[model samples]
Target: MITGAQLRDAYISASNLIGNEKQKVDELNIFPVPDGDTGTNMSMTIASAAREVSRFEDGGIGQCASIAASALLRGARGNSGVILSLLFRGFAKGLKDVTEAGGQQLADALAIGVEAAYGAVMKPTEGTILTVARVAAEEGKSAAVKGASAVEVWEAMCEGAHRALAATPELLPVLKKAGVVDAGGKGLTLILEGMLSVFQKGIVIPSENVEEQQPEVSVKRAVAEWEGEITFTYCTEFIVGRGDQKAEEDAKNLRAYLESIGDCVVVVDDDEIIKVHVHTDGPGNALQEGLKYGQLLTVKIENMREQKRRAEEEAAAAKPEKQRLERAEPENDVGFVAVSAGEGINGLFRDLGCDQIVSGGQTMNPSTEDILEAVQAVPAKTVYVLPNNKNIIMAAEQSVELADRKVVVVPTRTIPQGLSAMLSFDPDRPQEENLLDMVRAAEHVSTGQVTFAARDSEYDGHRIKEGEIIALNNGKLTFSEKTPVKAVTKLAKTMIKKDSSFVTIIYGEGITDEEAEEARSVIASKAGDNVEVTMVNGGQPIYYFILSVE
Candidate 1:
């Protein structure tokens, strides 16, 4: 049986392991685009649970799991994080009211989590975290039925996860071509391994690796005062979802109007919306100006002086509470937070047992402020943040010092690796063991992606034209073709060399099911007999297909 204390230790260990292996996870990103980040997302997802576990006085295993599940749900940022939270939620329900659970109970809990994860996703697919988790849980259940101990059953489960992960390439041609396992599947294995380590050994203090940081700003003070006195007390911002009006025209008009009223006027527009940032005395006038173009989706006005005064007062009053809180006896657990962008990807992480999600990606990077809000929202003593996108990693790390919760940032740079790292997590093991396991799994992946060129560009000695299909290996352009299927096959072949066993292709927006099947057939022919191939609907924007190898 595993006690609540053991479960707590396992969570802490998992977070640490994710943090250590984060870089390896980042490297597995399929795109060179600044947004490829999965390991970071998984790490952050689990951190929410870790932080929640840290908040309670020694509680039963069930209580800790419940708290972790709840915290993960609200703190979830991206697709992976949200899914991860769902998995834990099922686990919590399965372990309900129990101070501890035997191997049989744990197996049941794993099954429950798997079911919940599947339920959360709109369309479940093979060759991903869902596959790895379902297979592993079945193995665990079988082990338990054979009268294995909790440790023994979990070990079997990990082995099963490894096997399933290795098989992902066969199921998905992209994975086979990339010569890497499913990134999300690999992450799930790491989570299980981390938990196993806690059960087998004691908690180990994490080694310090000084992470670089942006210049720390006391944003928590809620205000900045200048000696020159406040010319404008409020910072106002609004986003208008584009209607029939052209963004450029709207931006031009908004800019001209803001220039007349505000000194610091910033207006930016994207395909979907226009964002206006300005320092103004009258926020109403700024908002009124926005109404000319379209519907306002979001609006914010911050009173600099009032915010500062309140922050200062709150900090002063909370000093004693903070001191007492700091002196409280330490617990053995930690939690994580992640950011993701899609439903399928979200479900993949949840099935692996992530604690939270921060919804964002490519076209939009969650501000440091958004990440900070998630960190504070998680009810844990210590939380880890994963900014899966390389661009967001710095922003995620920036939230650590600002957070009252002890925060660790694992820089996972891609969705695939982020999912792989979470699969590596385990709640039954010591911290060091789990951390090492997660890191190892993340390091073992190679990722590839297939997309179309936004414009013609001649670089890296490859002649490229607008509308050409392109394939990338860890961010570098490898091939360009006329057809999506041919481009996908070429990319897969480039990635799946000797020793390849599995391949997975996740098709995205605008791709029809018939087209995806055609692409699959081409992949199957090239995959050879030893390899398996499969396809899925990622339903994401931008890229047409994401491939993985193992």
Candidate 2:
């Protein structure tokens, strides 16, 4: 039988092991795309659960598993992270109400976890983490049926996982072509091996290079000190769901009410929701006033003075830390949160009515927690989130469940699509109407990108050489050129249709203003003067220019 404490220790060991080997799994990425973050995503997802479990001094196996599953769901970052969370969610369900788990029970939990993972994915692909988990669970079930002990069952599961991971190359042609196994499978295998090591060898792997910590001040003392310096003690925030209420009027009234009681107030309203943030001594009065707007979501109250004191103490102890942004209640009806990189792009989104901009794109995908923080910061009833990248949509979607506000993801797969969606948004309309309009507008625009090929490869019959300028039309590699201007011109010609009227070119960091103008001139020469051409300094990395034709 495995105790809850033992299970927690095993999970910590697994997280540490995966962290140490994350780079190895990352390198196994077979996709030609430059961004490879499978290993990092999986590691962070499990690390979240490990941290949560460490806080529990005593609990049943079911209690501990549930805690881990909950944390994983909230912290899930990417596709791999979401899938891993689903697997653990099923495991927690299977272990529910059980204080201890035997070999047979553990095997059943693993099998359940695999089933949940497969069911959650729209199209379950083989030769990935799903296949590895399924095979390992089946092996564990077999070992349990043969009267194996808990440790023996776990050992068999690890062995099966390794075997499946090694065979992934044969199942996926892309993996074979890249001379690597599945990255997700490799990551899962490392986690299982680490867990097995704890049971079989009694070796607990410490987290990779973790520094020792110093703890001194108590929470009571911290709060007492905080009360002395700040006029307002409670930092309150909540989201109100719009239910047959006038968003604009209600938001204005709420802002007035909050301002009367507190400072640093922010009130944002939209067609479907209203978000409020304020620092006040009387949080109950604020909550009462918020109920008039709609049902409250994500009600949070913290002592700001306490947080400030903590930051000061950490700084005094020579520990460098980033300062937290001050929270203000929303004062608008509609709020927009956009994910973008580069100062120019951020400023553009801000100019286009975006309330908050999350700094992430391409190689660095923001986690679900990052998106959630951004969502909470926007004080509005209905908050629209533009992921602005295909890979980031899932992570952004996960924030909806965790947020207090009514978060509607606009599903913008590119920066151009995001900008077009913003342009189409009508603040006077309902959320449902705006959603359709924004999506339709984004769909009508054709996006193209020009970036240098990261590696030499043959893709779609095109011999792409490293450092060559490659033009991608609607995400497909269409052509390559020796120069960015030529590639942009060729890409623009291909993207421009008979009905296309406007061509917008957003130049990135590597290209100077002169180079951007030259590229725009080449595009205009090839595309004809009939099409209206515009240029903006995007200053983003990875791509030389992002083009949108509509």
lDDT of 2 by residue, 1-550 (tens): 7767667767777788888888887767644456637888898888888767755546788888899888888777677887788788898998998898888888999899999889867789999999999999999999999999989999889989999999998998877876788989888888888777766775656556453111111123211222112458888888998888774678889999999999768887788888888879999999999998889877888877677567547645775554543444666677999999988899889999998888888877777877888888888867899999887887788788787767899999999999999999998898899999999999998999998876667666677667788889988989888888788888898899878899999999889899999988888877776899999999998888999999
What digit string (tens of lDDT, one per residue) describes model 1 on residues 1-550? 8877778767756666765675666555433333435666666767666656643546688987888777666555345555566677788999999988889988899899999889867678899888988999999999999999988888888999999988998998766755666767777777777778877664422413323110111122212222112357777888998877774677888899988877567788987789888767889999998988889999988886676566556545754642111222224366767777777666666676555677776645665557777666666676666676655665575566567768777657666667666777777876667667666665565677777765445546576776778888866888787877778888888888788777878788778899899888988898899888867677766677878676
Q: Give the TM-score of candidate 1.
A: 0.44
Model 1, residue 504: distance off in Å is 34
RMSD to truth, every model: 24.4, 20.3
Q: State the number of backbone clashes in model 2.
A: 19
TM-score of each: 0.44, 0.76
Model 1 stretches astray by more than 4 angstroms: 204-360, 363-550
Worst 10 residues of 1 by lDDT: 212-221
Clashes within 3 Å, all models in order: 107, 19
